[model samples]
Target: MSITEKAHRRSSRSLKALFGVLFATIVLGVTLAGGMSPATAAETPTPAPAPTEESDFTNTYSIGGVLRNGDEVLEGVDITVEGDGFSETATSDEAGEWEVVVPGKAEYTVTLEVSTLPDGVELRNPDAASSVVTADQWLTTSITRSFPMGEDTRETTGFGAQLLQRLVSGLNFGLLIALAAIGITLIFGTTGLNNFAHGEMVTFGAIVAWIFAVLLGVNIFVAMAIALVFGGAFGWVQDALLWKPLRRKGVKLVQAMIVSIGLAIVLRYLYLYFIGGETKAMNVGLSEAVQLGPVRITVASIISMVISVVVLVLVGLFLTRTRIGKATRAVSDNPSLAAASGIDVDRIIRIVWVIAGALAALAGVMLALYRQVSWDMGFQILLLMFAAVTLGGLGSAYGALVGSIVVGLFVELSTLFIPADLKYAAALVVLILVLLVRPQGILGRRERIG
Candidate 1:
């Protein structure tokens, strides 16, 4: 054969070898893909991961405030915010501003170091030398907590003026107490359950209002309306999720009461966990105190009293005139008898819960205005609530109204004679006296103990 013909044959063999190598590579790739485990296949990026929730992310929450005495900026003041082995301190800058940035969300103690104050400066209320504030708050841009630095001349007023003021304060306080007492009374009458968690209901209202009025910058009255609606819904939810189910499960009233206590504890802690133990003043603006002779009370107090009275009156009308109200009363009197009379006892009880929740929440909002809203504000007044209920007599709405007023007046007025701290004890003493005189309560009927 010629040299050219030999070269062409060699070229053909090389070309065939290249094609065979390419086919082997393709087959090998297919085999590897087919043999791959699901776990390994998942590693291949076909679908991207979804974005994480805002709560899942860790962001810096700034805890800061200004230290000012009237128009004067007070510098060199040290503020500390501490939580669970983490502590940070910040000194006021030249502009009287101080800030401490913390990681994550948690309840923290924000203390105004009184020792660091200037020689002439002092906290207005020594009792409020330190405040417990939250770190890493959600949906709130401002985390400023202020400590008033001035002399409190509240005690310098004349005796009679103080008395008149106390009376006004008592009236306002009593009305709020009445609102809560009436709710508890209605619930107890219908269900025979001592809902210790009712206080949390109050707190829930206040917190809701705070979220709307303070955090979200909604109007105060609008926030209050939202709070009332939410409060009622919260009550309905409680019955649906917890109380009603337990009732069907044949749980005893005593066990149900215990459950209420546990629920209260859990809710209180949850509030603390989320909102911290801080006292938040819901509305920013302050209403001037109206002077009536020797008496002095805020315009806000008057509005609150008016609102409380109107709501109470409405509640009274509801119980007496409405079909559901009468049904509730009938159920409270005798659940089995009511049920036999073609009344849905569960429905009436649920309505009562809704009313109770709404009323408690309204009271909470007013209380928040009177004294700033706190995580344990409701729990603090739980004793007074029980007292009011007991004083009025069990299962009597009118009695609760009367009892709460009397208790509220006695508590505030007693401060004139007793130490402010001992006033609660004084109120309890009166409750005991009332109980001794009438164990059946002011309005309660005498029922024989089996």
Candidate 2:
């Protein structure tokens, strides 16, 4: 009847509608992941067996390229690839391209026999005349040979080019960290609950994507979408079933934090038990490198960076410009006051949980693509996510973004001077130094310490 009562009624209706939509989306995701859609259920194909660390390289390895004689593409040139226990020979097609798939990872010698070359098209590098290419774990490697019309020769990549390559890699890594850190900061802002199990949410995304993409034969992009939806659903269920009741029971923040730690432990080992300890690769096979100026990167890494930037910008806009976003900010500032002013604090917290889960899952997917998927993948990055949030400021989303990017770059670029294994430690060291200089964090407001 009154304005206050009407607002409460409207909010309740909206909340119910949100829950219903989320539930439907989750069900559809599960069905797709299971390969049980009504249209495909009857003809669902059996999944291929998973690969193990000791699994033999049954898949063929291939390497080829377009051979150019100055500005003209050369053709009909013999490209011989010979290795221990394997040998293959092929002639270049009309396009001047040649490829060979070796059976396994072995030291291979690729030779361009001088007899088969066209007249006056001599090998530019005598060293590359019989080049050795060791095909290791990588799915493929490119071979670029020089055959200039004149006496110009090929040169190795310079130090400046290598530095630029590392910089691009750092940017890619930093963007992924930013994606996950934003979710952590958002949840902390709205609920004031430190979620230790947040890293598990990241693992959940990768694992689900692996299952759907690799096992169920879903398209990789579709599988990632399903994983994101499932992650959001998992968050909603977690809040509805666990944190909501705990809050209603008046559990102290410290006690709740302890509970989250326990939950995290349970989820981590459960993932190990089911997924096993071996690292899992995505179904998407190797991608060729794309050169940009002085740096070269994979297509996946570039796409991940682009997606991270777009999603983060959208989130920033949502937090600043939308009605619910303003209300969420109000609740984060003062829960009791916001509640008294007709803001549904619990609803806002629930929304935050969903958003946090989705973002973390997306981060996990990107991480898995960059690295490999393993049970402890999320655990490994958990500390970095915390550092990002702490360094950015505990409850500031923008601060988390800034902190994550800095940490990502620090972890990557530090490898230049220190051992690669100590890169993570270097990031932590930076975090400590930043805290000493500005205890409130880079963007964190100074709060009462007592």
Candidate 3:
């Protein structure tokens, strides 16, 4: 009896000790998860202080652009920017560029003093005497006036000349669409996600460029470069955070597509909130219209078109020739088979996103150049982009290019017959007719049935 009682007492004490330890562990875990003790909380450092108001003034706003008559730069011309309680004047340099900083956000009138002009040269637009510029941020606004060599007279332009002008305009517009559409098609080919939010990427690029080039006064080229890099990074982050996770979870393609639509709505509103509803202009200013045979085109427009064409051609070559480009094509054709063949499927997908983002951003910048930057600018062109993608074939990059050119031409040229407002509608009608006839699109492969 004594031996058994002693053994039982020892066991009871050991059991009590174990239970006491377990209870203490539970209490400690709860405390740590909830909050630190008052003494420890007080010792924690505060977050890094937010930027000060004075720091914001580091970025200054200026008004500037080039003044030219055809190819000749007009130097020594006095350009005056005036507003209530603020005025600044600048002379055009040898390059015909003039710039002057404004006090802050305010409405200012830019006037080209005709008295300061040379004897033979006169402003093309008499009403261009005073251009009212509203500077809401630290941005460089272009106030360019054309100084034609002869007296201002209304000349009747022939139908052929008008058609040629519209054709050039259409080509410029189509090239921009192609840039964005190719990116969309590439992303679709690789991942099979339609990516409705691709339009937001376009908006993002333009906004970022405005912030850097206008707000911070960085060089336009440098700002564009940074925006492109940021675009690529954004693409990577999106794939890593959302698309990759969804794919891992075995989400259906339809669900993913819906998710993209939701994302597009969110991003569109966010852009509106941050960028505001007002249209923002780039610093490139107004380019003088040059006579190109029968067409009169702005120098800026010509340069933009050249850049777009060259870049697109390079992109095409890259897709057909480069190692990564080939890998991208393989993945787009068949992901599982590409993976089985030892390609890094996820890496290829990520690379495609980066490329898509960069291209979309470039397109946004070009769009801003063509029209003023606005919150819904990207969304406005999204339907046209879809038409291009569909007309080209949903998953074919080259097809997107061809389709965008057709859409662009139709949008601009149709204005001759229909109202300019209905040109977009006309393009959609053309898209419908083409699809009805080909079904597989211009460049899409036809599926064979057994």
Model 2, span 1-450: residue lDDT tens:
999998788667655544554465456456554654333344769999887668745554665666777666778888888878788887878877788876666777877766777777866665566767765535453444343333665668877887788788888898898888888888888778888889999999999999988888888788889989999998898888778866775656786787778677767876775677889977475355788998888877887898889999999999999998999899889999999999999999999899989998999888888897999888899999999999999999999999998998888888777899999999999999999999989999988878
TM-score for each candidate, following the candidate numbering: 0.67, 0.67, 0.67
Expressed as tens digits, the lDDT of each residue in 359-415 for candidate 3 is 888888788778868888889999999999999998999999999999999899997
Each model's lDDT? 0.85, 0.81, 0.82
Error of 1 at 9 (Å): 94
Better of 1 and 2 by TM-score: 2
Per lDDT, the best of the predicted structures is 1
lDDT of 1 at 201: 96
Question: What stretches of model 3 exceed 4 Å from their correct place?
Answer: 1-152
Best by TM-score: 2
Clashes per candidate (backbone, < 3 Å): 0, 0, 1
> What lDDT is reached at residue 258 by model 3?
76
* Model 2: how far residue 228 lies from native, Å: 1.1
